[model samples]
Target: MEIVQIVGFGLIAAVLILVVKEQKPLYAFGIAAFAGISLFLLVIGKIDAVIAVLENLSERAGVPSIYMATILKIIGIAYIAEFGAQIVRDTGQESIAVKIEFAGKVLILVMAVPIISVIVDAVMNLLPTGG
Candidate 1:
């Protein structure tokens, strides 16, 4: 459907860039960037549905809404960081991309700390310490 068309066009754009890059590197760079952005924008159309499903699943699992929200934020940070890193790499800035990825990992870990603490607390409660 729409996704098929978007993928098809994205592939065509990629191929075109590859072909065009040999003679016009500047144009190729712009085209590659534009293609990447367009694909991301197209995929964004489905993000809402995905988020809704996650929320429903989280509720059904009896998990706290705050945990679910944090998880979603972590996921958002991951995807944005990955996307940013990829774009930076595509522009030949591998060092910056690595830094971006590192930052993303750290942020994700930070966001996960509360959930980890909750798990640790639950396990501790179940341990049944000696009186």
Candidate 2:
């Protein structure tokens, strides 16, 4: 039911944007951006719930809190960057949108470095030592 409402809202927004785009392109862009933001906000609670579940599972698995936090931040960056890129793309800025996505990928890789190092260390420890 909630998904239906969301879809309906999105469809209505799309129609409104199309109708206004001919006479007022700026308004059409505004409509698309607003719709994207509104939809993001609506799903925030669900996102929080998922994060809570992941945190609990990580704790149970004895994963360090820092690792979990870093993972969550990476996820957040990906989502926020994609959202921003979409909004900019709506304004017909393809290059800016691509740049935003590129930045997000770079940031995610940077954030992942510590985790990667830890994994490499663990793997090295598991290997046979040279006599």
Candidate 3:
């Protein structure tokens, strides 16, 4: 299975990183980052396939392209921020990792505002208004 290969690759990288870490901390970080990116690259095609399926389903459901795009962007931001945070954390920067996550949350919130407002409007329309 592909998962087995990924796990094996990850385990090998982990061992290599651990071995190098004692003598070369910087290289250890580099190894961790490179491994993380390589793993991401391996799954990128699957990510695209998922996006395509979601887009197809959204179209069938009559969802606006803008909403779908926003949702995808939010997902992307979360993944990228977490990835960056992990890389920074590998370098022993916990504070910076936290900041990166915080920034991602803020950006997600900003991107979500329009969708939230649309939902609120829909709900308000369903309520009875006093004449």
Candidate 4:
């Protein structure tokens, strides 16, 4: 059933791309992007299920919850950044796309800071302190 839906959508997207290519190139790009987003949303339910499974596995394996959350956050940020960059590029705003990518990187770094600080603090605590 899922495969059928995916193939059906893929075909529709291909046809839209071809039609838009002849008539409106920009709109062709837009349609392509819209198709991608639509497909993503369609499969988002599977993502939730996968996350639940991963959470269960991580708990059974004694993995830290924070680590799992951080990984998921990173994945989310990467996906969003890529999507934004592609849209900007499609709109012919290369400079803005570059800035958007830079901003995404900065945001990811900021988000990771807490994990980094924790590691740094742990290492520092392990060092012998001279009185």
Residue 112's lDDT in candidate 2: 99
Backbone-clash count (model 3): 0
lDDT of 3 by residue, 1-131 (tens): 99999999999999999999999988998899899999988987789889999999999999999999999999999999999999888888999999999999999999999999999999999999988
Per-residue alpha-carbon lDDT of candidate 1 for residues 1-131, written as tens digits (9 for 90 to 100)? 98789889988998998999899988988998898888888787788899899999999999889999999899899988998899889889999999999999999999999999999999999999999
- Candidate RMSDs in order: 1.6, 0.8, 0.8, 3.1
> How many angstroms is residue 62 displaced in model 1 relative to the true structure, after the best TM-score fit?
2.5
Q: Whole-model lDDT, candidate 3?
A: 0.95
Clash number for model 1? 0
Q: For candidate 1, report its TM-score.
A: 0.88
| lDDT of model 2, residue 7 | 99
* Residue 104 lDDT (model 4): 85
Question: Who is ahead in TM-score, 2 or 4?
Answer: 2
Would you give me the overall lDDT of model 2? 0.96
Q: For model 2, what is the alpha-carbon lDDT of residue 34?
A: 90
Better of 1 and 3 by TM-score: 3
In model 4, pairs of residues that clash are none
Model 3 residue 34 CA deviation in Å: 0.8
Model 4 alpha-carbon miss at residue 33, Å: 3.2
